[model samples]
Target: MTPPPGWYRDPHAPHLERWWDGTAWTGHRRAPGTPDVPPVPPAGGTGRAKAVALTTAGAVLVAAVVTGAVFLGGDDDEAETKTGPTATTSSSATGLPAPSPSTSEPATGVPDVVEDELNGVTFPLLDGWVRPEHVAQDDVVMTTDGTYDCPGEGSVCRHGLVVSRTVTATDQTSPEALAEEDIPEAAEDAFGEDALGQQPYGGLESHRVVKSGPVAVAGRAGYFVRWRVTTAEGPGGYVQSLVFPSSVGTESPVLVRYVFDAGEDGPPLADMDRITKGIRPVTDADSGGGVGSSIGPAH
Candidate 1:
């Protein structure tokens, strides 16, 4: 594992810092009180680490960013200390910035994750993402990078970000059934009719169903679908769907929908994956119920 790029406590010295150039430990070391000094290798420990890009995104990176972790040996709890440098400086080896790439820039302060429980499932919301003004249902929790332009020929768009998730139990629902009901129908409205089956799911701004495959949702066999739709705000990213069996009394199935817009910087596929994979049903042993009933709509 490539140690994150930062100034961590020099295991050799109590308050001194060693720069982790996102690869191996750099001979570069810095002391506290001084922010502009160069890093030099401390007293001991040879420096060598096979490194990868610092842009790999996920929970591990988030954890490192949150705690401002130091590079002790990977998986080695022997030399860790509770201290770190408190200044802004980049690594001489990797030239990467302090903090980390996974550090979020949400409207609010950065949080490891903003989480909530809905429809008997608990999941994390993106930090700084704002709640949508409207939702399909109260039980549906919707938040976005920012306000979406009003829907119009060209003015309406989900520019940048739109994250919404909801769980609904019908008489019954399945992966294929939800796809049949939601995908083709929605694409038809965005484009003409059968736009999904007629063409690829992405490009052209016209809505389309691009790809699909079998997936496991909440440990149940399910499916996932990706869609591209036209928006006035900007070209939209993919809207994903996950349908699976509800953890309820073993009858009602659940359907969860996701609409993501990562912004001009491109879709935040990593953040989306983190949130999606974090979903879990509250079991009877944990929450005492199957799935919770809808309260109202998002407002």
Candidate 2:
């Protein structure tokens, strides 16, 4: 049987040439492998064979023309079929070419920041205070000269101090509720009976609502209360507490304490004030999961 338009049967091979009809397919069929070479006409004979030969030549020419036309038309039709209405519609909708995944570009936009990382928050350390060797991960510890002068040798008499704050994820629970139950527990864990001299500061002192300020660690909210206790040692060391709420019922609230030898000549209280006020929340973009440190002087 003759194949449909745009389709051809290769007589020399067992395979069929499938055709894309712009919208659908045309079935396959067998066809002659080679073009038939027509015989030359006789000079001057109106014989029956000559007449038959002429007719056959004309039919061959017509078939050749038809075949060429069908192939050329099929080429144009196939091109249009590949780039037709559906392709245009998709391109318009997405405002880009259809994605050839192998050749596609990576996605473009701002990257997201995680809230739990604490690396972005920074505090300015007061001048003349030396950072210590045993600093905690999220805490910045420093020391200043106090009533006792720096000793010439081992374990100098200078005041020892630690300052730290962190922001961590929390639930919807109010900072007051979390602090009411959790702060005492955490203080005891970290400071033992030394946690004794707890007092309310900010709005928490009046038994009213505890107010929270912006968190330095992202995705958290709360304020810290300041507590003080004097050590029994002769150097007369002092410890100050700073505690704030974390995500409800989860991670512990951030706790920072400063310990130092008590003295009239120590650094001014203004330094501590500056550090506390400077603390603020940090986003993932700022911390990169705490891999890097934030820029600023130590407080």
Candidate 3:
């Protein structure tokens, strides 16, 4: 049951104490022994718990932004640290921001749009795609439902994957530089060797740049680099790294990576363009920022 209104360890910053007003975390914080300030009133009804099917819409990319361990590691341990909605209070001491409740009904279906509010953007869910579960550290990720036994032993790999996250690991701001630097690592994470030394695509042998240059994404200027990767084991696919200024917040660089298996088993290469064109600021929906789309059950 939700604990009675009181102070508790701050989930975002364990070094301090924060108030939990019987329903949700509040912005009020204090040192362990300091006198408690009046608790902030809870907002409306209780917020929805974290969804098992998808990450929170406003999930922030705090802490380590990118690490080898985060790329499709498929670890259950990461899920254990995820908490419910963050308080909407403007206090900076509240640690990471909490997600607003999702509008999609609690059903075994896919929403037409998926949001990464922390980065201030939304992604369109295209045909043959669904929100990914268990892909650690990706602020927003989706993949084709179809999967096959990984060429490497002891794991499964999806045929297509798309991931977007803020580039918090560096202070750099140029989208071109960030996109170029991230593609190689993105390719390695998808087709090359993993942390466990498992070559999911039989080890990325080489990559040929298919396209590289400036582009537009989500109404922001961006840059993208797409490569056709060759693997030693399976038919390798295409990988693209696109970086753009976030539509909201500090305008920190946001990275969107795409991976698709080669040939018929993977999503159409055109999907990358479709998805890119479909991205928009979450505020745009009511302002004509989005196109008409249909919601469907997860495949």
Best by TM-score, which number? 3
Worst 10 residues of 1 by lDDT: 61-70
Best by lDDT: 3
After superposition on all C-alphas, the RMSD of every candidate to the true structure, in Å, is 20.4, 36.0, 11.9
Candidate 1 structure quality by residue, lDDT tens digits, 1-299: 12455665443333456665543335455556455444554456434321111101111111111001112122221111111222233333234444322111121242333222223344455554444332211112334544443222322333323222222323435666664455543332222211113211122355666556665544456565667666433444555555556554442444455555434544465554555555555442123212322111211
TM-score of 1: 0.42
Per-model CA lDDT versus the true structure: 0.37, 0.29, 0.57
Q: How far off is residue 129 in model 2, in Å?
A: 2.6
Q: Please estimate how well model 3 matches the true structure, expressed as its whole-model Cα lDDT.
A: 0.57
TM-score each candidate. 0.42, 0.33, 0.63
Clashes of 3: 1
Candidate 1's C-alpha runs over 4 A off are 1-118, 128-138, 151-172, 186-205, 230-233, 262-267, 284-299
Regions of model 2 farther than 4 Å from truth = 1-119, 134-141, 145-158, 165-221, 235-238, 245-252, 282-299
How big is the positional error of residue 108 in model 1, measured in Å on the Cα after superposition?
A: 20
lDDT of 2 by residue, 1-299 (tens): 11122332211122333221332222222233323222232466311111110011011111111001001111211111110111111211223333211001111232121111222333334566543332211123344533242322112233445444332323423444443433333323222221122211101111121222333323344434333322222322233344444332334455444443334554555554454444444322223213112211222
lDDT of 1 at 142: 36
Worst 10 residues of 2 by lDDT: 63-72
Candidate order by TM-score, decreasing, is 3, 1, 2
